[model samples]
Target: MSLFLTLKVALRALIRNKVRSILTMLGIIIGIAAVIAVVAVGQGATVMIQEQISSMGDNILMIFPGSASSGGLHFGAGTRSTLTPQDAEAIMNECLYVKAVSPMVRAGGQVIYQDKNWSTSVNGVSPSYLEVRNWELKEGAFFTDSEVKAASKVCVIGATVAKELFDTESPVEKTIRIRNMPFKIIGVLVKKGSAAFGQDQDDTIIAPWSSVSRFLQRGSFNSVNQLLVSATSIKTIELAKTDITSILRQRHKLSEGTDDDFSIIDTAEITKAITATATTMTMLLAIIASISLLVGGIGIMNIMLVSVTERTREIGLRMAVGARSKDILLQFLVEAMVLAGIGGVFGIIIGGSTAEIVARYNDWPVLVSAQSTVIAFLFSAAVGIFFGFFPAWRASRLNPIEALRYE
Candidate 1:
């Protein structure tokens, strides 16, 4: 028989049992839908995470003061002030892979302007801080190196600080008081919503390290709280770390057996860890959903076996009338594929709509890429072929005389 006649015969057979065919496709429909929705949400979340990481910095690394052990009591990292502004300068000047460096000290107090008061963090940092953090100014210029060297009482504020203190007024050239000392605002930073840890990114102020150390900090020692560094390139991040470790160790005069008094955290490594977690979750959900598709394929095989038994005399009649076994095989296989293909199409539509509904109501991100859609459809078709083959083979092997004798 011709291919077209075979298809026509297959369709006719399925049409005779429309309800059963539809029921058999249910598992595939649900499975495909689940896979699509899960993948879409996962991809969207990954993209959002990447954006957040980029906003944090480009090729950035954070160095914190090492832990302190006193009287057998050990405190974790950032508990002791072991770093200094001079160490940051040494790294910037001597490290080959380092692109930028900023030494930082932190203080927090209520910032007051006129009658308005807002509590926020005040950070002391060098001019290179803007580059190391990939921060941008909303208005006005950053404080110059000359101002930093002079320990000038000048500062820049974050977007949250600007809104709470200045309202509609531009913060440039204004003055805000922290710790009973006034500092002129030289710039306003662009808004960054939040950090991965859920801290408000825009609720802080920036000032030169010299000015902050002199006016804000009440410490007897010249120690810094943190160091922010940017590598020359992403590929050179490890090299930058090596150079920094070597420079810091040599400057501190540490012996070969002595432990270093600092910790370095690579933001890129954190990004990879987060993205990998998302990918793993997506794959896990997809695998669970695929189980239903497998079950649906089994349903098709069981139904096709029953179909062969019901049409035993018809099979004998066709075979006796010159219908080739291959033709019989093709008809049954096509019927099975048609069922699965139609189910897959419906599944895709339902899945996409469900994702859109979730995104619209919950304000969540969901992306249904063409690659995923095509993959889901192809997998459904493959399931049909794999399950349909056994029943088709059994039908083709029927003895014509014996089948005719079957009641």
Candidate 2:
């Protein structure tokens, strides 16, 4: 028989038992839908993470006052005020690869705007903090270098802090209190959303390093908690780090044999770690979803076996009327494929809708690519072929006389 004729015959056979055909396709529908949904969610999460990383200047490097250890023990770069504002200034002035640097000093306090007060982290930083972190101004200008140098009482508020303290009102040129010291609100930062590390980057306020130094001056003016630096390029991060370390060692008067108390972190390293974690999660989720497809495939095999038994006499009659074993096999396989293919098509629709709904409510980035949908549908078809083979082969090899004579 021609291919079209065989397909028409298969369609008629499936339609004759509408309920059974629908029941057989259920496993395939569930399997495809689950797989597609899981993978789509995973892809969306990965994209969101990458976007967050990219937003905070890909070439940025963070200099903290501690050393990273592998054995979960704290030893190096510990118990010292190792990093200082002088080191940050030295890097900016001396390092060729360094583009911008900011020394950050954090203090937790209640930020008061009128009667409405919010507890938040106040970041003492220079004017270059905005540039190093790639922050954008929403309302007004950032504090000037003179303001940072003169210990002027001015600040830039983050979006989250702005909303909590000022609501929808303009915060520019207004005064807010940090630890009861009034500082003029110079600007509001643009919304940064959540980073891959789950840190709300836009939740803190920025004040001049001089203002913080004077107000909370138990230590030296040159000393700071951490330094945030941005390199000219990602490729130049190693050069920038090496140059900064040399400059700091010379400035801090450290000997060749003495271990440096400062540690530098490349943002690219953090990005790599986050990407590796996300890739692993996506693979694990995809693998788990594949188990559902395997179960569905087994269901198809079982149902096809039962279907062959029910249609044994019909098969016998067709064989007796000059139908070849290959034709018999092809007919059964086509029926299984048709079932799975239709299920896969609907599954794609449902999966896409599910992912969109989740993203809409949660405000997460969701990507539903054409490649993913096509792959899912083809996987379903492959499952049908693999699982339908045994039943098709069994139906093809049946003895025509015995099949016809069976009760």
Candidate 3:
């Protein structure tokens, strides 16, 4: 018989038992859909992370005063307050790869503007912060170096704070109270969404380090907390870190083996780590989903076996009329493939849309790539063949005489 005739027969058989056929495809549908949704969401999250890291400026290094600890154990990278504003300035002036540096002073207090009030983080930095972090001003401008030198009461507002206090009105030139100290609004930062660490990117205030130090008292911070530095290129991040370390050691007058007080966090290193983690998660999810697909394939094989038993007399009739074993196998295989193909089609649609809907409602980053859709569909088809072959082979190998004599 021709391929078309075999397919027509198989499809007719499926249509005869519509409910069973639909139920048999259920496992495949769920498996394929789950694969697509999980992969798409994972890819989206990875992209979001890269974007956030990039927005914070590439080739960037962060140096912190506290010791780096994970799971309550300190491993390394914790530096003492040996990094001063002078060290930051020396890096920019001395290191050939160093582009800009911003030594930070972190503080938290209630910000009061007229009748509205909100508590948020306050970062005391320099004019170079915008360059180091790749931050852009949506309105107004950053504080001038002279303003910082004089510890002027000028500040830059984050998107969230601006919205809360100004309500779409221009916040420029408006005075808001930070811990009762009046600060004139100089700039409003563009919204930067969120980071992989779940930190809000546009929720903190930026001010001159001098202003913060003078307002909060300079003696309170004997050592600088962190140094945000940007390098000329991604390749030069290591060079910049090495040069900065030497500069700090010489400036701080540290003896050998005392342990470096400051640890540098390279943006490229961070991005690589995040990508590795995301890839591992994706692989694990795909493996779990594949198990479900395997189970669904087994269900297909079981159903096909039952079908062959029920249709033994029909097979005997065909064989007695000179039909070959190959013909019998072809018919069964076609049926299995058709069932799987339909399930895969439905699964792709269901999974893609489900992922998109979830991402949209939850404000999650999600991208359903064509590769994932194609892979899921192909996996479903492969599952059908792997599971359906055994039953098809068994049915084809049956004795026509015995099948005919059976009641």
Better of 2 and 3 by TM-score: 2
Positional deviation of residue 111's Cα in model 1 after best superposition, in angstroms: 1.6
Give the local distance difference test score of model 1: 0.88
Candidate 1 RMSD to the correct structure: 2.4
Model 3 TM-score (2 dp):
0.83
Question: Which residue pairs overlap in candidate 2's backbone?
Answer: none
In angstroms, the error of model 2 at 290 is 2.9
Question: What digit string (tens of lDDT, one per residue) describes model 2 on residues 295-339?
Answer: 888888888898899999999999999989999999888877777
| Order by TM-score, highest first | 1, 2, 3
Q: TM-scores for all candidates?
A: 0.91, 0.85, 0.83
Clashing pairs in 3: 67-78, 79-261, 79-262, 80-261
Q: Which ten residues in a row have the lowest lDDT in candidate 3?
A: 75-84
Residue 131 error, candidate 3, Å: 2.0
Per lDDT, the best of the predicted structures is 1
Q: What is the lDDT of residue 375 in candidate 2?
A: 98
Q: Which structure among the candidates has the greatest TM-score? A: 1
> Which portions of model 3 miss their true places by more than 4 Å?
1-6, 49-55, 66-79, 114-116, 220-223, 232-243, 250-256, 267-288, 313-327, 400-407
lDDT of 2: 0.85
